[model samples]
Target: MLFRQLEYLVALARERHFARAAQACRVSQPALSEALRKLEDELGVLLVRRGRAYEGLTPEGERIVRWAQRILADRDALRDEVDALRTGLSGRLRIGSVPTASGAVPLLTGPFCTAHPLAAVELSTDLRADELLRQVRDFEINAGLSYLPEQGTEGVRTVPLYEERYVLLTGPADGLAGQPHATWTEASRLPLCLLHPGMQGRRVLDGVFAGLGLAPAPRVETDSVGSLFAHVRTGHWASVVPYAWLHVFGVPPGMRAVPLVEPVHSTPIGLVTAAREPGSVMARALREVARRTDLAGVLGALPKA
Candidate 1:
C-alpha cells in the first residue's frame, strides 16, 4: 500500500535474498518481510514463495514486481522534476554500455556532468547490445550507449551518437600492412585474434564475413577487448576492430590500422532510452547533451585508421 513496501518488494526481487534485500533497503530482514507480507494482504494476493531461504517470487509477484519497477521509476522521476524546478536536476544517472562503445562513454558523461553539475553518474559498460536495450526498457538503467539493434526498438527511443567503421589492426610485418586498405577477405586470412562470437562487435563482423562467404578462423578468441589488443600487440595476430576505439586505445605500438575496404561497413552507435511516455529527466538531459556533443568531431575526425 505504501511506497516503502513497494521499494522493499522491488529490492527483494532484485537481490533475491531476504538478508541482502534488507541490507540494500537499510532495514532488518524481519521488517522487510513484514512490509511485503502487508503489501500482499492489502492487495489480496500471495506475492512471494516462502522457504527457510529466499525462494523465487510467485507468478503474481513477478507481475507485481514489474508494476513496482514502473511505479518506482515514475516516483523517482517526479522527485527529480520537483528538484529540478526548485533548484536544478540532481540524481544518479545510470547508464549501461556495450563494451565496444566503452571508450566513448566518457565523452558523453563528461558533458552531462558539466551541464548538470549537481547530478551524478553510474556506468556499467559490460552489457551487450541486446541486454543493454532490455535493461533500458525495464527501467534498470537510465540510458544506454551501444550499436543500434536492427530490430527490437519498438519500445525504445534513440539519439544517434556516432558511427563506427571497421579497421584491420595488424603489425608491420603482416601481408596486408602495406596496403592502402584491406578487405574482409584479406583480413580473414591472417592469424587473427577476435572478440567472442557472442559479443555484438563480433557478431557484426561475423555477419559481414558470412555475407562475403568467408568464415574467419581466429587463432585466439576472447571476451576481452584488452586481451584482443594484447594478442595483436605480440605481433603474432591481427584484429579487426571499430575505428572509434582507436581514439581511446591508439593503434597499439608496432601496429597499423588500415581501413577495411571492399564494402566498407559501419555500425551506428546511439543513446538508447525507453520509449515510454514521460521518460526519465536525467535520460532526457543526457539526450540533449548527446545532441550537442561533438563526438563525431572527436572520434570521427580521426585519420580513418
Candidate 2:
C-alpha cells in the first residue's frame, strides 16, 4: 500500500532478482521481501513467483506490475508539479536516446536549460526501443528520443521529431565518393562498415535493402558511430549512417557524404513520454522545446528521403 513498497515491487520486476532489486532500492533483501509479502497480503493476490533463483512473475504479478507502473508515474508527476509551482521549474529531466539521434539531444537540452537554468538535465544514449520505454514507464527517464515502434504502447505519448535518411560515408579516395547519390543495390556492392543489427538504425537499413531484394552484408560492423567513422576515415571501409549525423561527425577529412537514392529510405524518430495525469514540469518544458525547435529544418538539411 505504501509508495516505497510499490517502488520495491517495480524494482524487483525490473532486476528480476530479489538481492539486486533490493540493492537498487537501497534496502536489505529481507526488508524488500517482507514488503512484497505485505503488499501481496493487502492485495490478496500473489505478485511474484518464488524459487531458489529468480523465476518470472506470475500472470497476476504481471498485471499488478502494470498498475504499479501507472501508480508510481502518477505519484512522481504530482510531486514534480507541486515542486515546480512552489519554486520555478526546478527538477531533473532524464532523457534517453538512440546513438543516431545523440546529436539531437543538444537541441532539446540547450533550450530547456536556458529556460530553466536551475533544472538539472541527465542524458543517456544508445538505448534500445523497449529499454527506453521501460525507463519512461518506471519514471527512470522523463522522456526519450527513439524511433517510434510500429505498434504503440498504451499510456504513452509520442511526438514525431523527424524522419531520418541514410547516407553513404566514404573517404575522398573511395571509388563511389564522386557520386552525388547511390542506389541501395549499388551501395550494397561496396565494402561497407555498418552498425550492428541490434541497433534500430541498422534494422531500418536492413529493411531498405530487403525491400530492394538485396541482402546487405557489411565488410565490418560496430556499435559505435565513432568507430565506424574512424575506419571510414582510413579510406578503407565505407559506412551507411543517418544523414543528420554527417554534420555532427564533421565528415572526417577526405570524406564525402552521398545521399542514397533510387529507392530512398527513411525512418521516423520521435520523443516518447509516459501518459500520466498531471504532467511533470520537466516534461512540459521539454515538450515546449520540441514544439519550438525546427526538427523539420534539421531533417530537411539531411539527404533527401
Top candidate by lDDT: 1
How many residue pairs clash in each candidate at the backbone level? Answer: 0, 0
Model 2 lDDT-worst window of ten: 296-305
Error in Å for residue 206 of model 2 = 1.2
Q: How would you encode candidate 1's per-residue C-alpha lDDT over 184-231 as one tens digit per residue?
A: 998998989999999998999999999999999998998777787788
TM-score to true structure, per model = 0.93, 0.92
| Residue 65 lDDT (model 1) | 93
Compared to the true structure, candidate 2 yields what TM-score?
0.92
lDDT of all predictions: 0.89, 0.83
Residues 214-267, candidate 2: write the lDDT tens digits: 997898988888888898888788888887776576666678888898788888
